[model samples]
Target: MSTILFHEIVFGPIHSRRLGVSLGMNLLPYDGKLCSFDCIYCECGFNKDFRTKTKLPDRENVRAALEDKLLSLRREGITPDVITFAGNGEPTMHPEFKGIIDDTIELRNRYFPDAKISVLTNGMHLNKPEVFEALQKIENPIVKLDSALDKTVRLLDRPNAPGYSVAKQVERYKRFKGDFILQTMFVRGRFEGKEIDNTTEEEISAWLELVRALNPREVMIYTIDRETPAKELEKVPVGDLQKIAARVEGLGIQTNVAG
Candidate 1:
């Protein structure tokens, strides 16, 4: 049941396995996790286990805090490669997400214009006009799509929305029009007794079809790298990840593997 939670509005210039020198922004409450999906491999743990009593950080507070952090980094002669929106939960869930992203862009231009702005979202909120517009403005909008099958999505992601489905998710991602990055987590495990693995032949074949249809700017295939709330989960090997990357590369799309 090990989990990691960010306690500050803007924390870290931590080295990311994929995005280098990332300065993270947490729009969710500092006290707990808030997400649309309760992923089995989430490092933030189960939502029920980390409920928050505090409110989400307001737009002004987030702007001020991020500006201060950017100023401090400038003073230290450190330039982040990316200012990432990956906090306690789904960043797009924040009511003021659009405004915060606008502020982040402004601050990044003023401090480190070379740095990219990225938001790691579950892609559930894309239907929201504000979320969609905000994501479109960012340099890296990494959307998660764990499986091409509705059953696997239900078993793995445990999305809170009753109407959530693989078809709808694909449609939501299609709105990006090849502008977004598709991120998938490959894992093998048993949750509550059912076997779960997205690396199977059937899984990959179906997933590949969707990949071809989407034709994203890049495909990011990764496995669990931290202690997950569901102890039964196991990481997919780096070699396997590279093999999968090869299949994606065959489509003439850029791919990155972080196992």
Candidate 2:
């Protein structure tokens, strides 16, 4: 068994593959790990055993903590490259998500006005008026799309019910047109007894077609990098990821392999 990563409100001016050196806001909990999906490759492990009491931090508390972190950075003369909304779960799940984004954007303007703010959303609420509207204020609102087919998506994402299908997600992306970024986590694994091998030709073809249809500003391609609940899983190698990226690039879509 692996040791658990503690839940917390903020964690790192740490380097990120997608976003540079980022300061994270963990709205979840110091012990909570909730998510819209129970992905096998999640860095925080499955949300089951770590489900939080949903004792979300009040807006004022969140602002205070974020400000403290920013002020500390300023005092030390250390400036992060990005202020990110990410933690143990899907960020959009927060009840005050819009307000949080507004507050974060405002703070970004104050402390590190030069820094960019980002949200790592699952896109489950991409169609929700509230969620979509909030994302518009950010400099980079990266959304995930691990598969193009409904079944594969269901297995890979394991989203909470009431969230709709791949078609609905594509429709949501249409609203963003070419502004939104698409991030697909590639790998082979089994979840809840279902085999999730999206690296296969059939699955990749379907995914590439979706990319062509969606026409996002860019596509981020990467695989598992941390310990997950599903220990039986195997990580896809860098060369394999490059191969997949090449295929997507052939469609004339911009691709980043998280290198």
Deviating ranges (above 4 Å) for candidate 1 = none
lDDT string, candidate 1, 136-185, tens digits: 99999999989999899999999999999989989999999999999999
Please give, for residues 1-259, the per-residue lDDT of candidate 2 as tens digits.
4635545576788898887889988877767687888777787777787776768777788888898899999999999999888887888888888888888889889999999988888888776788899888788878889988888877777777655588888888888867877899988877667687889999899988889998888889988877777776778888989999898788888888963
Model 2 stretches astray by more than 4 angstroms: 3-6
lDDT (Cα) of model 2: 0.82
Q: Please provide TM-scores, in order, for all candidate models, with all chains considered together.
A: 0.99, 0.93
Candidate 2, residue 227: how far the Cα is off, in Å: 0.7
How many clashing pairs per prediction, in order? Answer: 0, 1
- Point out the worst 10-residue segment of candidate 1 by lDDT: 102-111
lDDT score for residue 218 of model 2: 82
Ten-residue region with minimum lDDT total, candidate 2: 1-10
